[model samples]
Target: MVAPLSAWPWENFGRFKYLLYGPFLAKVVRSRFQEDGPEDSNWCLHILIICALRGLIHQLWSSYSNMLFLKRNRRIVHQGVDFKQIDMEWDWDNFIILQALIASIACYIFPFLENLPLWNTKGFIALLTLHMAVSEPLYYWMHRCFHGNHLFTHYHYLHHSSPVPQPFTAGNATLLEHLVLTGIIGIPILGASLMGYGSISMIYAYVLIFDFLRCLGHCNVEVVPYQIFETIPFLRYLIYTPTYHSLHHQDMRTNFCLFMPLFDSFWKTLNGKSWELHKKISSNLGKSARVPDFVFLAHVVDVSAALHAPFVFRSFAAMPFSTNLLLIPLWPGTLSVVLMMWAWSKTFVYSFYQLRGRLHQTWVVPRCGFQYFLPFASEGINKHIEQAILRADKLGVKVISLAALNKNEALNGGGTLFVNNHPNLKVRVVHGNTLTAAVILNDLPKDVEEVFLTGATSKLGRAIALYLCRRRVRVLMLTTSGERFQKVQKEAPMDCQSNLVQVTKHQAARNCKTWIVGKWITPRQQSWAPRGTHFHQFVVPPILPIRRDCIYSDLAAMRLPDDVQELGCCEYTMERGVVHACHAGGVVHLLEGWTHHEVGAIDVDRIDLVWDSALKHGIRPVSSTKAKTSQ
Candidate 1:
């Protein structure tokens, strides 16, 4: 018997439509058959084909718009224009191939399902309501499971490996992962069908909506209209945006949802960065400005000893009578003095001194010295550094170099904490240790085949030892920990490891011909060195006293250009003849616009580059003899 028209039976009959029509012309035949069938017949095949076409068109449109956004705002976008590289294109191509395969499978299975009436608008709405209710919670838990250690390493890691995702990256996953993801979307629709709430038309609409939202999430460009959320503040919790999903790829610890932020919000997993990123992108909408070339130097005044000094006390006493003083008394005056010191730390660009090549501007951020190097002050000091970085970001500075104690705190993965915490930040933080190591390496005398390096476990100390070993120089490393020494020895090249000798006793260094004193070394310890030994001091405060018997020099000094007589800070007086190597490293990085972090020991080859760039900016290295003669 013929299936009843009221039950919308044409969906079951479509299985034969394929056999009756030619393989290449099946779509045309299906459309003609649907037109000739009863008015209420379920056009299942036609609906599936329409959904596929809609998804394809929407993906192409969204991808084009995303590309335009990235191109126009390349400077603010993470990973910059590297998204257009050939390797990324290869990744996109693989994703498209897999997605096409999945679409083909869906088309094959859809024709066999029971059909509901095609014209039932009420059923379509009910189906969508049911799908949302059942799918979101299930998808949330499934997504969390994907982030678990085992699953993340085996299944979900490929999708997260790319820091900056693009539209095509949405479907880029392992075959098994794609199947599971597909089931998460499909099971709810199948359940709705079993409950007698959906039709072929509802299925088509859902698929189109799902694919569009997925592409939007991975587009890597902020396309949400800022005014909509601003007008209705609650809408932010209701809808998900590209920047929202980008943070998931950035930190991987929060922001897990398909199209709604409801689950993430309820679970307290929504990233705070989402709102900040939205504000940042919204403020600069439609403007494609390049990040200006500027270097930020973060330094602190000598506040550790400021309170007891007569000069500091006098300065505070004079502050209350100054024309700029706000009329706050006693306790407020004390608070005001502290606030004034912080205000003086504001970042300002130095454009007068020109660096050779493409760099010219330098921004200085002078933090209060009391916050650094003291016990229990790290948290406070880090906060100050965060504020400085944020201010530098406002100035469109691309690279920030942490000076002295700042570098010491930011060595290794310390800077990564700041990057992860401030997702809206586009500025790169560099410790500038590499260039500092290069400067010290350049000053070592050629006659010194064997040298003793104190604090060899420190970042700069280890770097110096490695650089010396690479140059075939024998290095005697003095450190407190044997385990650290073994680790460093193992990391060195096998040939170089033999030349590296670890000495636990500080007195053993006295037998060496030369000494490289790291920041950890004190002045009292230097007296133990042999009388005629050459001492190269790398610490900031000049720990070693000038002894008549030893040849002492600070390797951290750089020569200024011939035309420029001296470098001086308006706030404080700097020592004559040379500046600290860390400060000079910031200058070199700024001149070259090198935004990459320079944390470890820099190669010897880079010394020339830094030197040449310094010259371009009109900076040079003064020979020890010349510096002494000039003094």
Candidate 2:
């Protein structure tokens, strides 16, 4: 019988996804904590880490080696390179690894490159001969073919454009060319050994030597002794010269052998070349990577975190207290109502989402409602909170803060969780500099609808409650804390929107099917929105609000959503590819709020029962409430 077929073959294929995000994430952690030590040490560490990683990965993937061999991500190079030679054009690292990625994956699906019988199982020498005869020739030939397709220049040009190649520059290629290269280079080895012309282990070694030498061939060294090469003609016969490889970058038509001078000799494309561009290429690369010794991942994290201050301010500002107002004169009595739900928070949340950087990464695009195997979000939940705000038809949600409400002269400690004589709800803003979350609560709203919650007295929670606590509106909180946080999944709170029949959050209330979230959060969360209902309850964000006076940066990854057909008068039209880090003199975009949530209220009179509900769930009410009863 023929050998067994693979059942769950691609299962381990997920390993490839790791490389896509692993380095950036590692870089983030390293940047935040570890300094890269000395330059020589840094190089040594990188080399060691790579070598160790390669060994472990190869072993771990050996059983599933067939799959890893085929994947686009499994690589011999430190990084990927895009095919574009124009240094200014490549937006990020993914473009660099394009070739190796394309090649690896194709081999997984179709092991075509070294497909010849009798070449496998004959042992090391036979395997070496077959690999040398086939894989090298194929790599050279296809490497040459990639140059001919002018329209295909996007893939090939990027490879040669690296006048100075870094370890990371190895993987770069246009996605398509990556696939082509993988097919030509990887398949033949697998196919040949399968036909029994040689042993797989020998072929493996040959492939390793070929790759290691090729990398060394692109040297940034000035110490190569041309005198020795001139002395040993047989050595010239044995090894590929540094100048020979660099010449390929200069002229695409010749010098294609990646291993020995086999293909070049057979095809009459060999030249006795020498290494001279070493210093120039190294200098160029050094100048180009001038982004402070930190890895690119560090830069991205810096940008994303740097963006948080504005996002936080904008999100906090869109509070009902500031955005909407229904001065009920500290009175009571209101009718069952219709809520005018306009999320004042649209811009801020969208801006935060856009600037969060993780969304702009390659992973978010496919998230148009699909379970993509994100490299970074493996175990973490979404970090950003999502919610909706409902404004009553005649009774809009008003807001204040804990610090503003309490007027606590308790600038020096010592205070109990006291319930005050506030009518509607108290929005408290913090002012003082005390420890235990410096927030105070007082002065309330009346006839408020029910109050919806993601969790408890997170200082800001009291401020939000005071803004929306109208008299009769009910308050229902899906407690997000401790054990409860684990129970309340990301979708749990978003699902609260459905629990809300006639309540809305947000003050600059525009009519929309959306909810605004307060600072309600949980333990398990990722940088992106979680894949749950508390998340689904949040509305799909409209594209970011771009305006003319504002300079739009990060446009390479920006575009209109797929659904919008009519190109209405958008204030900012992305006319060309965005050159990143372009200094914008002023505020870029007017952000509203990132995570919007629903708001409602239970009568403060019934708030005792609410306390009971909270206490029963082991959650103390956000702030103690003193209500006027029907006495």
Clashes of each: 4, 125
**Which candidate leads in lDDT?**
1
| Per-residue accuracy of model 1 over 290-383 as CA lDDT, tens digit each | 3444454545444432231112221222121222233233335445545675666544332113234223233434455555656676666666
**Model 2: per-residue Cα lDDT over 443-502, one tens digit each:** 122333443443233323332333333323333433434443333222223434233232
Pairs in steric clash, model 1? 355-617, 356-616, 356-617, 559-620
**lDDT of candidate 1 at residue 197, scale 0 to 100:** 65
lDDT of 2 at 315: 19
**What RMSD value applies to candidate 1?**
25.0
On the 0 to 100 scale, the lDDT of residue 219 in model 2 is 36
